[model samples]
Target: METLLPKLDSVFSTDCVIFGFQANELKILLIDRNEEPYKGWRALPGYIVGQDESIDDAAERILYELTGLRGLHMEQFHTFGDVDRHPQGRVITVAYYALIRIDGQQELKPVTNFARAAYWHPVKDLGKLPFDHQKIFETGFRKIRRRLSYQPIAFELLPEKFTLTQLQTLYEAILNRKLDKRNFRKKMLSYGFLKELDEKQKGVSYRAAKLYRFDRRKYNKIFQNDLSVEG
Candidate 1:
C-alpha cells in the first residue's frame, strides 16, 4: 500500500529585533519596506526563509540581505503564527533578538530590493509597526528586560569604556524607569566585574564621569565558582 504525503503549503520566515543604546536612548533597528502589503512603512528586518536553508542560517542571511548587517550574535526568542499575520497566506515567523554597541560611523544600507532603507528608531514612542510587528517587538522587549535581571546582557549595548552614568542610563532605558542613583551604583559596584579606568569622559558638556570597562575574566571566574558550589 502507498501513503499520500501532505502538501507543503505554509511558508516560514524570520524577523530580527536588534537593540542598541546611544545618547541615553534605547533604539531598535527598523527597515522601510519597499514591497507590497505594507509598502513605504517601517518594519523589522525580515524576509522569507529559503526552502534549502535552516531557520538559523536563514535568519542571519535575511538580516544581512535586508539591512547589510552581519556577524552579530542573535538568539531565537518567539515564534509568531497567527494565521493572518501575513497578508498573503499562512506564514510563520521566527523572531531573533540581539544587543549590540552602536557605531555612529557605520551606515545602514539594504542590499535587497525588499527594503528601501534601514535605520535605528528609538524604542520609546515607536508609534505603530506593520504586520503584527508591534506585538513582536513588545514580546522581545519583555524578554530582554527579564534577561537583564540575571545576565550581564546590558553590557553588550555599551561601548568598550563607558561611564557609570551611561551604564545606569542604559539600564533605565531597558527597564523603562528611573533608578535610585546611589543604590544602583552601590549594587553594581558590589558585583566586582566593572574595572574602573584612570580615564574620564571627554567632550561632554557636563562634568566628566569616571570610565569603566566590563571585566570578562573576573565575571567568568565568579560564574565558575558559583557553578562549582552548586555542584
Candidate 2:
C-alpha cells in the first residue's frame, strides 16, 4: 500500500534585525520594499527561503541580496508564524539578529529589485512596519536586552576604540533608560575587560574623554574559567 503525503501550504522565510549604535542612537536596518503587499513601505530585510536551501543559508543570502550586508554573524532569535502575517500567503518567518558598529564609510546598496533602498532607522520611534514586522522587532529587542546582562554583546556594537561615555550611551539606548554615569562607569570598569587606551576622542568641541577597548582575551579567560568550573 502506498501512503499519501500531506500537501505543503505554508512557506518559510527569514527576517534580520540588525542593530547598530551610532551618534548615541540605537538603530535597526530597514529596507524600502518595492514589490506589492506593501510596496514602497519600510520593512525588515527579509525574503522567502529557497526549496533546497537550509534556513541558515537562506537567512544570510536573503540579507545580502536585499540589503548588501554580508558576513555578519547573526543568530536566530525568534520565529513569527501568525496566520495573517503575510498578505500574499502563509509565510512563517524566522528572525535573526546581530549587533554591529555602524560605519559611515560603508553605504547600503540593495542588489535586488525587491528593495528600493536600505537604511537604518532609530528603534525607539520606528513607525509601523509591514507584515507583522513591528511585533518581530519588539521580540528581538527584548531578547537582546535580556542577553545584555549576561553576554558581552554590547561590545560588538561599539567601535574598536570608544570612550566610556559612548559605551554608557549605547547601554542606555538598548535599555531605553538613562543610567547614572558614576555608577555605570564604576561597575563597567570593575569587569576588568575594558582596557583603557592612551587615546582620547578627536575632533570634538567638547572636552575629550579617555578611550577604551574591549579586551576579548581577558573576557574569554574570565568566562571560560567559570564555564569550566561549572562543567
Candidate 3:
C-alpha cells in the first residue's frame, strides 16, 4: 500500500473585497465557488498562498488569478486569523480591497476553475456569504471610507472624464453626508488641484456644467502638510 502525505497545521490565503461604484450605487465582486463547503454560494475572491512567494505577492497573484485583473494598485487592509474561520482546516487569510471604475465590466472574467462565474453584487442588499466574508467586507468598506478622507483615492472610483456632481457624489457616498454646493465648489476650486477644462457635461436637461481634472502636481503642493480631505 502507498503511504499518504502528512497534513500541515497551517495555511495562508489572501481575500479581496473589490468595490465598484456606478449609477449612484456601490457593488462588490463575488464569485460562484465550485469547491467544497460552499460550492454554489457567493464569496470574495481568494486562494491559498505559494511556498516560494511572500504574502504580498501572493495576494496580487490570487486576485489576478480569480478576477482576471492586473495592476490593480492593491492595498492590504487586514489579516484575519480565526480558529474557526474555515471549515476544512486552519487558514489565516489576509484580506485586501481594490477600487475599479466598472466602465469596462466586460473585462472581468473568471480565470480560475474554482470560480464558476464572477459578478458584481449591490451593497444595498447582499445575501449570505461564505465564511467570515461579511465581516471582511464590512472592515474593507470602513477602511476605504477612512482612506478617502485623506488620500487621493476617490479618483480610482471615478470615470476618466467626469463632472463636479460625479466627483462630489463619490465623496458623499463615502462620507454619508450632504455637502453645500457653493461652499464645496469654492473650497475645492480654491485648492487649485482641479483644472477647469473647456469640456462640459452632456446629456443633461439643465444648464451644462464645466468638466475638470484633478491635478496631481498641484494637489501635492497645496496640501503638502497633514491636511485632510474629509469625506
Identify the leading candidate in terms of lDDT: 1
| Deviation from truth (RMSD, Å), model 1 | 3.6
- What tens digits encode model 2's per-residue C-alpha lDDT throughout 46-102? 999999999999999999998888888999998899888888778999999988888
lDDT of each: 0.88, 0.88, 0.81
> lDDT per residue, candidate 3, 1-231, as tens digits?
999989856689999989888886677888888898899888999989988889889988887777777777678899999999999878999998889888874567778898888777888677788999999989998998887756777877777777788877777776767777776667667667778899998898999988888787888877654324433
**Candidate 3 residue pairs that clash:** none
Q: Return the lDDT, model 2, position 96.
A: 98
Q: What C-alpha lDDT, on a 0 to 100 scale, does residue 75 get in candidate 2?
A: 97
Candidate 1 lDDT over residue span 92-123, tens digit each: 99999999989642568889999999988999
* Per-structure clash totals for the candidates: 0, 0, 0
Off by over 4 Å in 1: 1-3, 104-106, 223-231
Question: How high is each candidate's TM-score?
Answer: 0.93, 0.93, 0.86
lDDT of 3: 0.81
